[model samples]
Target: MKELRSQAIVLRTMPLGEADKLVTMLTREAGKVKAVARGSRKTKSKFSALVEPLTLGSFLLHAGKTFYTFIQGELLKSYTGLQHDLERFVHAQYFCEICDRCLPEGEPAEAVFHLLLTALETLEVDPHPARVARCFELNLLEELGLKPALDACRICGKSGGPFRFDPLEGGLVCAECPRPASSFPVSAASLAVMKRLLAYGFQKLSVCLLSPQSQSEIHQVCLGLFQHIFDVRSLRSLQFLKAGKPS
Candidate 1:
């Protein structure tokens, strides 16, 4: 057995057998790793609390042929703030789902790892989970090399207002150009907000005031981009979030 130590955030966990659990985590150094926590299902298990989803910790793992085994872990931050609110919890889950989908196994994804960590931390105190989510979506797309052209027209490289977003072309199409059949009209205000969200870091979202109309527009645009780029039909966590919200 080979011993390895790293800073990790628990992504998810599944029960393996009667007393053990299969843990999936995103590490700062090693990217995504799947390890088994022996006896984690038992009441007396030391790994039980530390392996919960969204917990950040330092983990010592024993590498085996198939999967690593959780040896020792020191809890850092459990992000308990997220658990207090249903909306926050679901949003956090959506963030984790995106990461699991976008990141490749056993690859070093330092940018994504840091992005998720920062997003999680922001979610703990940020009153507007939607803003954090939007920021995360835009940044995640950029990190995965799927960033849509928001500044200039994809066809003519012209920068101006009142553009339409073409999902198939993966960019904003200028008003002068012939719009694609799938292109949806986007207002100058909405486009500007999208650009600002992409350009700025998550921390700035706290002070940013986005109009209700702009929020809806940005949500639709980001959702369309996710479907077009990642082929994600629907995210379960997002569904839970919508269902839980007051109408």
Candidate 2:
């Protein structure tokens, strides 16, 4: 059997036959892989914690006739901190699902993998899961070739200050060059923050702040895009977030 090594984050896990598991991972080298982890359910199994959801590590996968088998896995960060919080776990799950949906077959997505793991670490370390989620959504849009028009209006090439994300049109629309269906509400400040999220790196967003209403506006904009591009609702984590106040 041939062996392969790759960096991966556990997307999900399901029970296989007795004492085994089917582990689905989003790999940096391979787009995604579903492999069998033998005896992962055993109490003394070395892969017990290593094969759980949200694990980031390197794995040795044996290419078998039927399916890949886990040979040995090493954990880099188990993200144990986030596990204690329900909202955080929801965020991680939704983020991983978005990633698994966007990537194509046979496409090596190293950047996406790193972005995901780093974003999860960011959520684990930082107090802003919602902000991190926004950052991830904007970056994902760009990576999947659906980069929003933050610079200028899609209708006109004018570079300016204020704009709104028109989901139906699929980009930002400036005040002057508006489409008939450009009815979605967005404030100048809200658009600026979103533009920053898209144009700059994640670190740039660390010190930024927005009002309560502004945060909702940013989320709605990105959610609209997510629905359009991926045909899915906002992150499942977000539903829990919206139900109550963040701790």
Candidate 3:
């Protein structure tokens, strides 16, 4: 059996039998992995602290014929501190759940793993958590070839001063598309901001000048697009966030 060590984020955990856990993790090298952690559920188990949801850690695994044994987890960052504030905790959870659900169907993209780490790290201090999340979703879409139409009409290839997102077309549709009225109406400014976000790297997020209104609009657009594509109402954390403000 081969041994592997890599950085990963805990996406979820479920109890198995007793004193054991089944963990789902998104790793830098493996994309996503499911492993068994023995005795982690017990009060005195050294592994309990390491298997938390959304915990970022480096893990050592012993690959077996059918599965891997989680030998150890060395914590890198645990954002649980933010959970003290209900809203921040909700937003973070929503962010993680979206990531866990929206990833592509194949080998894990290493770049995305790093991007997620950076965004989660930013949430620890950055004030514009919403902006960071919106940007991350857009980039994830682009990487997965699920990018929405922004600047141009997905149908007529119309050069954009205006266009509406027509998810049926998988992007904006031009007037040339029959019954373009069926498309969701999108404002020109919204298109511009969306374009800029996709055009720039995520690390450049802080440098942009965005008004409060613009930020909210971007958030709506992202949620709409993501929910439609993934077919989920929203992240579970979003509801918790709606119930309280970040501290």
Candidate 4:
């Protein structure tokens, strides 16, 4: 019977009992929340468009024993631009999936909420999907306190390059340091890109021109660390993205 009001962005939604939907959302006030929207599947349902994934809105709910019941909501941004391109849509879904799986339920994550919001807004206007994704991933990792040390060697404190990334060790390992079997070499160009991506933030991402090699390397390093720390080996959105890639 407790009322909850917050600014939220829909993360996922699914049909429930025909007329209702089970919705998962990330809120600025309360990390992630799952609620039931009664009659949302109906043609004229108030929540029909309000509960769609990626819609940002002000929401009202009543807390139940197991889930919150959506009372009402006002739409803020639908991010409809994402739907115009298949690649953008898939990337957006991937971003949501990471937040959905990683964020603890009911915990306040204002920083994270803003990070996702900004990332989505950038994705809406930016043509560089790969850059946007990597930026989001790195920033999300940092916000979650799982940020990998990329500045210097993990052991020797060496600030020089020709390094490899060891996800288990959680940073870069210089050539002088002992190599772990899980470590993968990181090219200098890729290293610079990663450093700047972390340093300058997403706004400057437009200026960086990434080669295919740098792009692939950055992806591998971030994905490797992401999987190891989160224990999430597979992502459905990522699979869809790869499957859709033109040969």
What would you estimate as the lDDT of candidate 3? 0.73
Kindly indicate the candidate among 1 and 2 with the higher TM-score.
1
**Model 3 CA deviation exceeding 4 Å by range:** 104-106, 175-182, 209-213, 241-247
Model 4: per-residue Cα lDDT over 1-247, one tens digit each: 5989999999999889969999999988888999999999998998899999999999999999989999889999997668888888888988899899888899999988998998899988887887888888888888888777888999899999889999888799999989999999888898888888888778798898788788877777878877886755588997886687611
Ranking of models by lDDT: 4, 1, 2, 3
Off-target runs (Cα >4 Å) in candidate 1 are: 245-247
lDDT of 2 by residue, 99-198 (tens): 7666764478788887887788788866777788778887888777776666667788777746666876666777787454744767778877877887
Question: Which 10-residue window of candidate 2 scores lowest in summed lDDT?
Answer: 231-240
User: For model 3, what is the alpha-carbon lDDT of residue 70?
Assistant: 95
Show the lowest summed lDDT stretch of 10 residues, model 3. 238-247
Model 4 residue 179 distance off true place after TM-score fit, in angstroms: 1.4
- Per-residue lDDT tens digits for candidate 1, residues 1-247, read 5787998988888999889999888899889889999999998999889999989999999988988998899999997568788888888988887787667778888888899999999988888888888889888888877777888899899988678888778788988999899888877887777778788868578777777777766777777777875745477887786677511
Report the lDDT of model 3 for residue 37. 88
Which model, 2 or 4, shows the larger lDDT?
Answer: 4
The numbered model that scores best in lDDT is: 4
lDDT digits (tens) for residues 122-141 of candidate 3: 77776777667667767777
What ranking emerges by TM-score with the best candidate at the front?
A: 4, 1, 2, 3
lDDT of 2: 0.77
Which candidate wins on TM-score? 4
- What is the Cα root-mean-square deviation between model 3 and the actual structure? 2.8
Quantify all predictions' global Cα lDDT against the true fold: 0.83, 0.77, 0.73, 0.87
Give the lowest summed-lDDT range of ten residues in model 4: 238-247
